[model samples]
Target: MSTPVYEKVALLGLGLIAGSIAWACRRDDVAGEIRGYARSAESRDKTRKLGFCDVVCDSAVEAVQDADLVVLAVPVGAMGPLAREIAPHLKPGCTVTDVGSVKRTVIEEVAPHIPEGVHFVPAHPMAGTEHSGPDAGFASLYDNRWCLIVPTPGTPEADVARLEAFWHRLGANTERMEADHHDLVCAVVSHIPHLIAYTMVGVADDLSKVSEKEVIKFSAAGFRDFTRIAASDPTMWRDVFLTNKEATIEMLGRFTEELFALQRAIRTGDGEQLHAYFTRTRAIRRGIL
Candidate 1:
């Protein structure tokens, strides 16, 4: 058997992402020991019972104590305070990383709290499901998914490489990206899509012409997929949009322009334009396949 990527890995949140990380790390022997902590006693209890963590601590500070790699897997808005709380407790040479999708905001929030000798490398695992909580995690959640690593300036190359190696051990493909570019790319690909999904679901909910029962009873595959995306953990998504406002709004504006063009095509019965537009989009889907 190969050596673990981290001797001690600490996860500061017990939600889906963190739980899945623990599960994946254990599955691949990525870490020699996994310790976890959640804000709520109930989540701590659940994590303890789940047994994915070798030791489940009640506090973030305790969990990060002497940990070689500490992962802040909480919502973006919560990372700052959590970083401050655990800063003094992190070992001098240990590395601290986060799984928040909004990279620029998270770097702004969590970077100052990092100690002089410690490394701060932010990463986002581009993988998850609509379900959340400890029960929602599985060992294969991150398999073959991209995990973007955003290395802060002045962070040593060795430290960044170590974090990339750790994620690879968790079965994720790793790539280094600039923080601003990371947020913008994620906004275009993830944040805006989720926002649109939530909006569509809300429109259906408020469409009094269609009864809620009917909406649920006759959900097409498209609408059902929208519902799935919109069903993601509300707190997490809320933090994502709020922290990633600039990029999200920019993308939303572009999406609005495209929507308007489609509306015009439909109203004027421009079948040729519509066909051309859909054919281009169909190529995108085929490329993804």
Candidate 2:
């Protein structure tokens, strides 16, 4: 067998991202031994049964000890406390990273807890279905996806490059970005869109005349897509909005202005304005395609 990138890797949370990482590492020979920990006993038990990690430890500190790479896959809000809990046990020179969507808040919360010799590289893997949890992950989840590495100003270039290579081995295209810029880009591409999906779904639910059965049965592709996005893990999204408040709120403000303009066009029955706006938006979709 070929040599592994890291001899040992510790996964601090065994949810979809971590579980998928373990699976991909095993499939690609990325790490020699993988250790995992989950806050919930049930999650630990499930991971053990699934056999993703070489060892399933009882605590975060135990899992991370002596590991070359440690990934904090917990929710955004929980990162700081988890960092503090595991800092004392992290091996010197071991690289620590996270899979949090919001980077600036994560850096503020996690950076201070990292010990002197260890490295902290915050990353966001732009992949995942609405489903979460250990069972929701698969080895191919990250294939063709983009993993953005948001390194701080003082971060070592070698460490950033190593982490970028690691993500590449996991089948993702890697790119480096600044933390604040990453948060703003994600707010426009992901966070605000999810909020809008949730709102539209909620509006559908609030319409008394539209029975729940009818809503489900008569759903078009657009509404169906909205429901799929609205089904994302609530705790994760709540922390995302709270932690990335400035960017998310800014995107929401812009979204509201555009929505009001569209509403006015509809109220006034301005067919030309509606057609032009829609044509321009449709061209944007074509650009994506």
Candidate 3:
């Protein structure tokens, strides 16, 4: 067998992303040992029962002690405090990375708390289901997915390369990007879409003219998919929007303008305009396929 990328790895949150990372690392034998910690006893218990990590610690301090790589997989809003709490405990030369969707705020919040010798490399793995919690993780969750490594200025190149290699071993394609650019790209691709999903679901819920039973019973594939996206962990999504507000607002503004154009087309009975718009979107979907 090949040598492990990191001899010891610590996962700061035992939720879906953290659990999946632990599982994937173990599956690939990329880490000699994996330690995990969760804020809730229930989540900790679940993680222990699932056997994702070699050791499950009750506190963040315990989990991170002496670990070479520490992963913060908690919600974006929780990263700052967690970083501060673990800063003193992190082993010298250890590398710390996060899986938060928003990059700019995480970098700003987490960079300061990192100790001088410790490396802080912020990462965002563009992979997950609407499902969450420890039990929702699977070894293949990140397989073939894109993992963006957003490095701030002055970040060590060696540390960034090591983290990229680790992600590659976990079956993900890795790319380096600036934090602000990563935030903007994520807002366009992920944050805005999630907000739209939540809004569509909310609109359906408020349509009193459509009975609740009918809404559920007669739901189409499109509406069902929206519901799935909207069912994502509320805490994570809440923090994502809050942390990536500027980019999200910019995307939302563009989305509103396009929506107005579509509404106008429909109101004016412009079948030609509707056809052209849908045709363009359909081609985009095909490109994705």
True-vs-predicted CA distance for residue 139, candidate 2, Å = 0.8
Query: Each prediction's Cα lDDT score?
Result: 0.92, 0.92, 0.92
Residues forming the 10-long window of minimal summed lDDT in candidate 1? 222-231
lDDT of model 1, residue 258: 97
Model 2, runs deviating above 4 Å: none
Instruction: Give per-residue CA lDDT, model 3, range 1-289, as digits (tens).
Output: 7679999999988888998998899888999999999999999999889999999999999999899999999999999999999999889999999999998999999999998889999999999999999999999989999999987777789999999999999999998888889989999989998999999889988988998899889999979976788989999999999999999999999999999999999999999999999999999989994
lDDT of the structure predicted as candidate 3:
0.92
TM per model?
0.98, 0.98, 0.98
- lDDT string for model 2 (168-239, tens) is 888899988988899999999999999988998999899999998998899999799767889999999999
Candidate 3 lowest-lDDT run of ten: 222-231
Backbone N/Cα/C clashes per model:
0, 0, 0
User: For model 3, what is the error of residue 221's alpha carbon versus the real structure, in angstroms, after optimal superposition?
Assistant: 1.1
Q: Which residue pairs does candidate 3 place in steric collision?
A: none
